[model samples]
Target: MLPQDLITEILLRLPVKSLLRFKCVSKQWLSLISDTHFRHHHRHASSGVILCRRTDIIHHVSLAGSNSDYQPFTSLCFIDDSAGVKILQSSHGLLLCCSNYKLGKARSYYICNPSTKKYSILPEPDYVSVSDNSSVYLVFNPTKSLHYRVACVRMCSSSFNSYQVEIYSSETRDWRSSGSPFAAPFDMVFDSGVLWNAAIHRISPTGASLCFDINQERLGAMPGLPSNEKWSRRRLRYFGESGGRLHLIEIYGCSTQFQVFEMDMDYSSWVPRYNVDIAPVVDTFPEMLRNCIVRNDFVLYAFSLLCLQEDEDDSLLLLHIPGQFVSYSLRNRTFKVLNSISTESNNAFQIGCFHAYQFMETLADADQYL
Candidate 1:
């Protein structure tokens, strides 16, 4: 048998996706991979895959490892129709999804660790009466804490004295409502915010600049958008995080030109990283995108920059391209189209809204916490 030190040294180099599968190789291997130290090493050593979902099917592509990562999609669990499975957010390695349960045909929320294929439905949030269907988001950073956190904001103002925020904690396995809220309530759209630091930052066109701190359960304003580029209704905008910093991505409708911006932690200001204008890519796939835009469908929303994977020189552009998802490499400036199905048929293409999240594959023992 190999020495424990040598075994750990070699195992640390293995990609997380492979390590997850290797857990079944043996009890020893499974225990070692589940070790907290091993998980940290694996998370740091490997850049995990980017997960994008096309309705019921969730497609994942590696950030660095192999070029043949165009793997097929994995179908998530939904009670009746696959259409009921909706991914609210992905953090660490777990996906916070809501599905229509067959028990009572009621909407259920679950935290699923895609790596281990383990999931558990959460009990209803604390007795704080959630009347309106509030938009919810997941916050899970394994490096910070073992438990995951979720918060929901009622997009429309409530009749109550203040806009209440509901929170769920995996540690306690219960939900609670915030007692105090900023006088001004949030009114941003769902999927327009990102979890960064200990707070959730939201971008609004009305210049609300809202942020909800999970730890403190307080809402406040932050730095606004850049003064140069004005917000436009035609452009598609999204907020993301990379390297512990917040990012803003704006893609012009049906255009190959996309702009990226990075924000400071304190929400002080915004800085432009690079104006990615893939003229050749557009020139090549002109008809495809043009037809998509002409459809005037909501699924054709702009391609948002999910995560800027860690690469010394080259940057990976993980975009949420409608119908089909593609990755752009800054080094070669080339577009590699990704598909969810393995079959080589153009008819497999379908038009729908899909979310591409910056995912990191980790075996962080979801069942232990949930």
Candidate 2:
């Protein structure tokens, strides 16, 4: 028989799909794979991106190499048949989803691991009213703890400028209000909340960006890009966390050239990290260029930034063109097609818009929380 350490070393090198099947091989094998430490190490071995379509279908695209494949995964149909499920957020390996709002039925929220097909329906929050608009963000870091947390930000019923935050901890298996109601702009949107630096960071084009510290339970202002009259009419191209850093991408008008900013650790300012120009890509793939005349000025809406991968030698920017997924290297000004979309999905992608979530495969058990 192989030594225990040798067995674990071999198992850690295997992909998640094979490791999941090996879990049923023997009692001892199952114990080793289910170990928290082993699961944590295995999660870092592979990573991918989950693309959520407007119709609620999910497509998984691996990021393990420069050229990866895309496969149709699931629509989360098993959670609830009567209710339509939509993925709201993705933190680490877990996903935060909610049901469509029906006239008579209350909305249902769920945290699920699509890899393991394990899910838990969250209990209804106490502070939310029917009239209030609420957005829930997931905060889970297996490195910090095995437990996860869900933070809900809702507008106060009494004041338009006041917002309240509530947190649900899997360890406690219950919900609790975090801090007191705080003041924010009435038009601030919480839909783009990204978990980083132990807080949920949300950006707004018209107003000041905000961040809510999960540990301290306090709301504070997040630094925004430097002012520029040319970029006044801000179009948020991308705002997400990648490679353990918060990144923001905003475009002024119809230009393909832009700068990608990375937030400093102190949360004081944004540093210009990468300069991106997709004109070459548009020239190569003419189908991506969509030109329209607005007020006698030509406006071009060509591509969307799906994700930014930060690596020591091979930093990449993933993009969604008309009918394909492309990876553009930041270090070297070159691009390659990762995968292609079907005819039906290409048409849908053009009309409906782009929604992407980073997916990290893990063996973290969700049964304990349930």
Most accurate candidate by TM-score: 2
Candidate 2 CA-lDDT value: 0.75
The lDDT values for all models are 0.63, 0.75
lDDT of 1 by residue, 201-276 (tens): 7766665577878888777677766643444434435567767767777654455666677786666778887677
lDDT of 2 by residue, 80-139 (tens): 636687888877788888877677877778888777777888877665542327878888
lDDT at 354, model 1: 45
List clash counts for every candidate, in order.
0, 0
Clashing pairs in 2: none
Off by over 4 Å in 1: 15-27, 44-56, 63-67, 70-73, 78-84, 101-104, 129-132, 155-162, 183-187, 227-234, 251-258, 288-313, 319-325, 330-352
**Candidate 1 overall Cα lDDT vs. reference?**
0.63
Provide TM-scores for the models. Answer: 0.79, 0.91
